[model samples]
Target: MNNNLQLYNTLSRSKEKFEPLNPPNVGMYVCGPTVYGDAHLGHARPAITFDIVFRYLMHLDYKVRYVRNITDVGHLENDADEGEDKIAKKARLEELEPMEVVKHFTDRYHKNMDQLNVLHPSIEPTASGHIIEQIELIKSILDNGYAYESEGSVYFDVKKYSNDYDYGKLSGRKLDDLLENTRTLTGQQEKKNSYDFALWKKTDPKHLMHWPSPWSEGYPGWHLECSAMGAKYLGETFDIHGGGMDLLFPHHESEIAQSNACRGHDPVHYWMHNNMITIDGQKMGKSLNNFITLDEFFSGKHKALDKAYSPMTIRFFILQAHYRSTVDFSNEALHAAEKGMQKLFNTVELIDKLTPSSNSSVDVQHFKDSLYAAMDDDFNTPIAIAQLFELSKIVNQVNDGKETLTASDILFIQNLYSVFVFEILGLISENIKGNDDQLVDQLMGAILSLRQDAKQNKDWATADKIRDELGKINIKVKDTKEGAVWNIE
Candidate 1:
């Protein structure tokens, strides 16, 4: 199972061989959401993308420690390093404690992820939970002189770290490039350099979520918690770090810079980022005011939605595109995914009930090779799905008796469909849900009970009336195998 798996690492900007720091064991960390609002459609891209990576790695027999963090305390809504916590702002508006806002949104985020069927990570460390670790990291950076105190706050000296490590390695920009256009936002002038970010910020007296720290009565800075908690739990360096493409610049880059500044080593081995979800070529961001929450999509409450889409349909839509390619949301594209997924699930169900023959028509090896190649080439699920459809054609033809499959071929398809569709891809067809003949049984029972009363009155016409009514609901009642069994057409 240890075939050379190729993944497009954002750190190197190429498809490189995925070599975990510890062979057969990988440590992965993704920057989870700053839970202040409901998670939108923009949230599912990176989530399902990494879920596929986790599943496929385990499928290849690797034990992965996937750590995704919760940013309960975050920077300002305007992306200002010195602004008030986003969660804190919500608490003030609702007149509740800051922790209350975190509790509500955190619960909502979990509920949303549950709907997507995204597997829970091995460790979900909260920023507030690891305050000591973050403070310890800032202390180490202070001792190393990579960070300096200003009043009660501490800022990382980005200019100093740039001397050794490339500051914009992940973003593909250099110091001069960022320094030129990195607009001078308010409140960041307190840092040593324009690019320097806060490692610890002194909280105001009115700030609702202040904690005692070495610097002051303050919480960890926006980017410091990831480096500290990651280093504390995973190690100085781990196998993979993943998130949305938006995090490449200041968030992830700052995390790497702060970690290296304190620990004197690079942090992650592989950097994976999933592309954004666009409404109409524009990024569906909060500022754009075009984002749709998962609940809206599920409930069909959005103005653009014709009807509610199931969770599996949304997951399928995201998977249909390459992880790095931006997918446009539209009724047509979504409908296509819905039709395509239903066809796939239906074909999977057909495999078990297919009657094997003495001969076979389809080449199972070719389908297997094609599906594996698509997945091995960075988990290309859309193309894998196309291959599934190709197999589906053969399965349906066999069902129609226009084609044939040998016993061995049938078993191969059964295992392939079960593994790829159910186990790995996590789709289930509605065909497996209830008793197969229950619908017809219920319909015919009512009709036949009425017919018995008609016969008791010696009324042939009334008995015939009940039989005709059963025909409308596709109930076909037949007397066979010791008693009458009914089926729906």
Candidate 2:
């Protein structure tokens, strides 16, 4: 196995060679969804990004225990710790139990991930289920004198924690700047500083979600869940902590403070963050009222979609860009990705039919080296994909009798695609839109057979009508020497 993988660390702001804290055994924790709404394109980015990390790490012969948390409780409406809990609000509006809402959306989230071919994490712990763990974590922070109880609510003392340790080192923020720019919101008089975040909130009688803690009959704060659950599953110091770059602020920043105050050191060795997906140069999020859910993209229900995009096309579109770079959503980009993905798969299918010669014209060893080299350099998938396209050209040449490949070289290319495209990239052949679907292919074959019969019988009207009617529904039919072919336009 080639073990020269390097990944970008958000803490140090550099691409560092990945060396696991414990050899052959790696622990990774990622912050999962809040589960109040549908899984959108924005959510897909981190899930697919960390999934590639998870897949590639295991491919290198490492035992990885990946834990992704489900935030079923304690996430409030704002980062300022004001307003009602997000899940509770959803439950109240729908006239359903809080857990009911959590279960419904969580199931949908799992379905979306399955369609995208993302693997489930080894341990998926939920915040509501781990109340005892979160409470115990708060007790440790309080005992360390970094938190204080105020009117039945416990808030982390950011100003006090700043005195002993750097409060904003992970986010590169200063306490002075935070204090100066902080707004004094309503119901914040209980805290010593406006920047101080809630560890445990004293829920009102009307609040939907509440638990009994030593400080108050309330729930844990939004940021406390990951710190508690991560330590429980992956130990106090884990190998990697992954999430979106949008969490680099108060959420992840507070996690650093809580871990340092309690355990007296950092909890994670490497902090990884994936960039956001955007629309019209703006971040596509539910808060912005601009996010297109995965269902909308798959079903073509959104006003922004030109046509329904398959799960594989969405995956390919995302992989075409580096995880650290912004991917802007556009119809043209998606259409091109769909075509490109089809071409790659078509070339792979053609490789199996090539006649092997005595000697190879293509440099198969150099091509294999290029594939590993792209993945080694921070998992640069776009570069790896480009290399595959170059090989696709070679595959086409071999099929066209312009280039030659020995039997061993043909086997090597087939294995390369199997590992890189199917295993590491997590693309499913059955989900690749058109020709890969057996049912659709069978139906199109029957329809084209009827059209060809009409043409052969000298019935010009029937043949032209069959072709014209299919075009009305965005399915184009073409006449070639091999008879008739139809495709989704």
Candidate 3:
């Protein structure tokens, strides 16, 4: 289980060699959705990005406990301390209970993730479910003299914490700059400093979500839930903490302050953040009103989409770019990704049918080495995918009888595709459903056999009719020396 993985640490602002706190056992925590609305393309980016991280760590023979939390209770509208709770607002708009709203959106999120082929996390804690832990954490911060209670609300004292620690070390923000730039929003007057953020807020009488605490009958702050839930599951310290780059500011920065203020040290060893998705060179977000939900992309119901994109096509499109790079979505790019995904799937099928010879022509070992090397370099999926494309070319040549492969080489190719494509990259054939694949194959085989019989009997009209009908259904049939091979176009 030799693994030399390098990952970019947003904390240190550089790529560093990955060293887990405990060898063979790693813990990772990622910030999850608030469950107030359907997941969009922006949401898919970090989900798939950290999913690769989780899959690759397991591939390296590490026992990983991955925790991604649901922000069901504390998240507020506009990410402000005084705004309406996002889930509560949505519940009001939909005329449902807050819990009902949470359950509905959470289920939809899971379904979208399932369609995208993302594995479920080892633990999915919800903010509402962990109120006691969050209250305890806030108490600890107050005990440590880094937080204060004012008018039944508790706020983390950014100025007091900064005097004893580098408050903005993770985000490279200075205390003075934060104070100067902090917005003077309504209900912030109670804080000792403008830069101070809430750990727990005293709820309004009409507030839907409230928990009993010594300081107030209110919900935990947005940032406190992750800090409490992560430390509760992964301990006071852990290996990796990942989320979207947009969270690097107040959300994650405040997490750093709250955790360190309680534990007297950083909670995570490595900090990873996936970049945002862009549309027409601008960030696509709900606030921007240009955001497209995952369902909308799948259904092609949005004006921006030219056609419905398969889940695998959306997954491939995201992986085609490096995780840290801004991925711009477009119809042309998605079409190319759909075509490329089909080519890879077709090559894998072709590889299984290629007969082995006494010798090999391609450097299978070199290809394997390059593929792993690309993955090792900060999970450079785009580079690894490029090498897979190269291997696909070799597989195609062998299938065309233009090249030869030994039995061992053929096995190597199959295993490599299984590991890199199916296991690590988490790509599944969109056209092939479980059990349906075998049935489809059996049906296609029967149809193709009927066509072969017609051709053998020189019944040209019947054979032509069968071929034309399959073509109309986007199934291409190719005639070869071995007979006719059918594939979905």
- Model number with the top lDDT: 3
Give candidate 1's whole-model lDDT.
0.82
Once superposed on the true structure, which residue ranges of model 3 sit more than 4 Å away at CA? 79-82, 433-446, 449-464
Ranking by lDDT: 3, 2, 1
Angstrom error of the Cα, residue 50, model 1: value is 0.6
Q: For each candidate, what is the lDDT?
A: 0.82, 0.90, 0.90
Each prediction's TM-score versus the true structure: 0.89, 0.92, 0.95
Clashing pairs in 1: none
Best by TM-score: 3
lDDT of 2 by residue, 21-98 (tens): 888999999999989999999999999999999999998899999999998994567653556778888798899999
- RMSD of model 3 against the true structure: 2.1
* Ranking 1 against 3 by lDDT, winner: 3
Looking at model 3, how many pairs of residues clash? 0
Task: Give the per-residue lDDT of model 3 (tens digit) for 29-145.
Answer: 999997888999999999999999999999999999999999899456775455678888778788999999999999999999999999999999998999999999999999999
Stretches of candidate 1 above 4 Å error? 79-82, 430-432, 435-489
Which residue pairs come into collision in candidate 3? none
